[model samples]
Target: MKPLFVTGSSPALRLTVALLLSLTLIFVDSRYRHLDFVRSTLSVAFYPIHYLAALPPRLARAVDGRLASEADLRERNSLLERENLELKSLMQTHQALQAENRRLRDLLGSSFKLRDRVMVAELLEVDLDPYRQQVLVDKGASSGIFVGQPVLDANAVMGQVIRTSPLTATVLLITDAAHSLPVQVNRNGLRTVASGSGLINRLTLLHLAKNADVRVGDLLVTSGLGGVFPPGYPVARITEVRDDPGSHFASVIAQPTARLDRSHEVLLVWTLPALSRAGELDERPLDAAPPAGMDTSR
Candidate 1:
């Protein structure tokens, strides 16, 4: 129904009315200071929506962290695998070089004078005897090893086989107190008994007369007189020659030519007669003189 003096509201008038309503609410909040309950009610009502809104971001962050961890693990594993492969290759190369060296030593061993064939063996360990220098090898009775067998390396005569078991054998190095060999000066063929000084690399030439022609730097070789070691094998080098007039004996010190502490391989000259008869011959009685009449004529 139309009435006299009626007015219609404009858009500006409607906006002004809404602004006034918002101002009245602000005034009421400031004056009462009690909006905590209202705010908590609104938060409880919209909690499910808030959780739903955060789901995508949390999922993205979790996925990113997992991917980073997986990548780091893969990189570490790959690096370790490569290092292992390189180490394996180095080990293979070392083994090949060792085998070649052994073959060469065997070929050169035939030049030495010995009755039995030579068997190439590896140096396993060195004994801790302070008075008697000794070494252990990988050859033993099972591999045709026996006592008194001469042991040599690529450079010179190393030692002699002293004892043997089924799989391991002990070698008496030339530098033991009990070890003595007939050696000759390579320069003048002067014969003398080279005795050990209880040191693995040192030896003493006994019975060297004051007028002997042995001097410093004279290389000593096996004289082949003892029937224990092969002939012409390098024994030692004269490092010192002391000719004291007061003492009738000349104090001479020599050094062995073999790389005793350095070599990883050695050769076992199968010259021990007891080893030849493994089961057929009775080694109990003949062990003393089995090879007595044997032609060690070299």
Candidate 2:
């Protein structure tokens, strides 16, 4: 070891000299900026290390911003969808109100032209039984609605009240298979029985002679022969007439003038008593009274 190296100074002395040299470099660099070029070179060499040290915080901020933007977008989209649904619901309600208003106006106009006392009733339910065309009205025995009461729409006769409860009543539409009414031709007063054909739009004229003076496009109205329906109310219109040489009766088909399937409101009519030939009130019951069990005290 002595042959390879030689020690000239003590360890304490060498440490003191190193400390002084470091302080001198620091002071010169801070005062004169002479080592600026060397500092810049070192910083350039370690630039990637500095960037890597700061990358975590920069990446965190970027990811946080992206997540915040996405959350805001989702919230805005949800708000827009809710507003759109609300608007659609409002529009639908407005349309329904307008339609109801038009129907009521038409009913009011029709009521003014009638001489009978009338009450308006809304439909409560519709019978789904295809063979039995019927509907339930909101008015019943409590409202003075009686069995066999005439039910009419704004346009024409719809049906008759067949059953009644305390709070509701059932109407038998004219299109039912078991329904029939006496009708007369508006042109020549040719009387006939119009029976339901089990079809909503069709009626069959029963027992018309082959030479009957019925024709297409003829308006048929109630004849007042039946105590259920009043006279001169529109019932149907003849659409077809066929007569076979071998048959004794003609085949006649008519379309109902009433909007039986579409009416949402109906009129309950109390017809005035008919006058006799002497201009006196006839004692005979001209209208069908309520059933024996029905309570009409209201």
CA lDDT scores, all candidates in order: 0.72, 0.74
TM-score against truth, every candidate = 0.53, 0.54
Q: Write the per-residue lDDT of candidate 2 for residues 21-106, one digit (tens) a residue.
A: 98998999745646745654664565456446546755776787677876798998999999999989999998898778778978
Q: Give me candidate 1's TM-score against the actual structure.
A: 0.53
- After superposing candidate 2, which stretches have Cα over 4 Å from the reference? 1-114, 275-298
Candidate 1: Cα lDDT at 127 = 39
Score candidate 2 by lDDT. 0.74
**Over the stretch 1-298, how does candidate 1's per-residue lDDT look in tens digits?**
7767647888799999999998987987655535534544554565456446546755776787677876798998999999999989998997897677667767887332224578998765433455668876767778978677778998898888766665666787788766777889999898987877777778888767787898899999987666666578898999999987776668799999998777768988754342334333322212112133321211
- All-Cα superposition RMSD per candidate: 36.7, 39.2
